[model samples]
Target: MTGLLPELSPGLVLAGAVTAAAASLWLLLPRSGESRAARWLGLALGAAALAGLVATGRRLGGLGEEAVFLTVALVAVISGAATIVTRSPVYSAIWFALSLTGVSGVLLVLGAQFLGVATIVVYAGAILVMFLFVLMLAQPSGLAPYDRVSNEPLLSAVAGAVLLGLLSLAIGRLTSDTACCAVAPRAAGPATQAAAPAPSAVDPLAADQVARLGGELFGRHLLAVEVAGVLLLVALIGAIAAVARGEAALEDDRRLAAGGGRR
Candidate 1:
């Protein structure tokens, strides 16, 4: 695959892959009166896209790491694409969880062990809470409750989350990330302060990956980490509270609909 990819320019390969991906998504998504040929074509395009993407990302030092990366990256890409296009919400959620797992693996391969682990933790909790919320909101009058929602309060929640994310990004940009690195000042002497290069230029070598990162995170930044955990705990509690309230309201509605109000 590597030898085969050299003839094709990276940009051209990427563009072709992206184009195939878009075509595949359009064909694969649910539609009225679909034909068999379109499904097969979509599958072919999706395979081609994955192959091209794998080829594009094969720049690691060893074949072993490349193989590992290729495996996880394919998992992430396939599941992520399927998540958006899958007709069933349950299938979509399952695909999304698999996608997160793949992403976490990729992060680990890229030397971000803590973040990789945190990604799984946060999203696992989020997905569980989301399922609870959706299940409670479903109309309990029998029939399939998958797409049988009365209304979508989740949309407003999503909107609020996006707004909050943007606000957090704005706040984050106001601080210097280099402060956490703590390398520039000590590495640069007083005479060389005027021409000291940015911390980005100097790459940090990791003799021990997980151990060093874990030590610093727990030993030095334990308080901040504990605070973050507390925040996560509070958020989970709030979500559970919301789910309970929604369930109560939904039960009342079910009773009213069945003509057994307050009995």
Candidate 2:
């Protein structure tokens, strides 16, 4: 283990950040009667992880762009984590809404104007409102028992950390590769067509953006879009079923309490 200790390089910083995030998630995830100390510790670890990640990141050219991107990214990550960790379904849903806003900001910064706006309009404005209505209809008299415990918290944390680390490493490698960042010259062969610009430099906004997106969705990915629509419909149906069950359970609980008091 001593031999495995790496230098305090950017890679090491990222590794430490990933480890801290995992530990923080493990500590912060909803549990039965958690102590204040554990919550504080988790918050501290989470902050440390955020700092570490910031320290390891390469500058994104302009300071204004970098700051804006960083701010939105932080909001998204923090809110997403809060959504996962909050015991109250209401608060969790609110955090998820905030996360969606942050995600929209990030997409806008990346030049995907339509997608950015649509994410909030579709998810936050529509789907999330529906979820809130379901919550209102289905919420129990008190905190539900299932809300106090997450499914396999330890495994989930470890899996998330592993995935984060893997993605970080892949991104780091991909960005550091000079070829990936540079646009190569067009080939001289007579058969060669005009070379396309680098993906990062492509003016996706220059086209009839919404129409192109619609064409893509309804053309090549039509089946996928249909499947996603079906899934959303099923999820809405499930929410209705859950609401009915919750109301029934609440009724049963109230009847039992009334009978006990009378006896």
Using lDDT, give the best candidate's number. Answer: 2
Q: For residues 124-198, what per-residue lDDT tens digits would candidate 1 score against the true structure?
A: 667655775785686364445444232333344345335644553454444336456444646356666556555
**lDDT of model 1 at position 215:** 88
Please state the error at residue 244 of candidate 2 in Å.
Answer: 13
| Per-residue lDDT of model 2, residues 1-263, tens digit only | 11233457777888999999999999999887789999999999999888888777777768898999999999999999999999989999999999999999999888777899999999999989989999999999788999999888878999999999999999989988988766443322323324543444454354677787888889999999999999989998998999999999999999999999999
In model 2, which range of ten residues has the least summed lDDT?
185-194
Models 1 onward score TM values of 0.60, 0.74
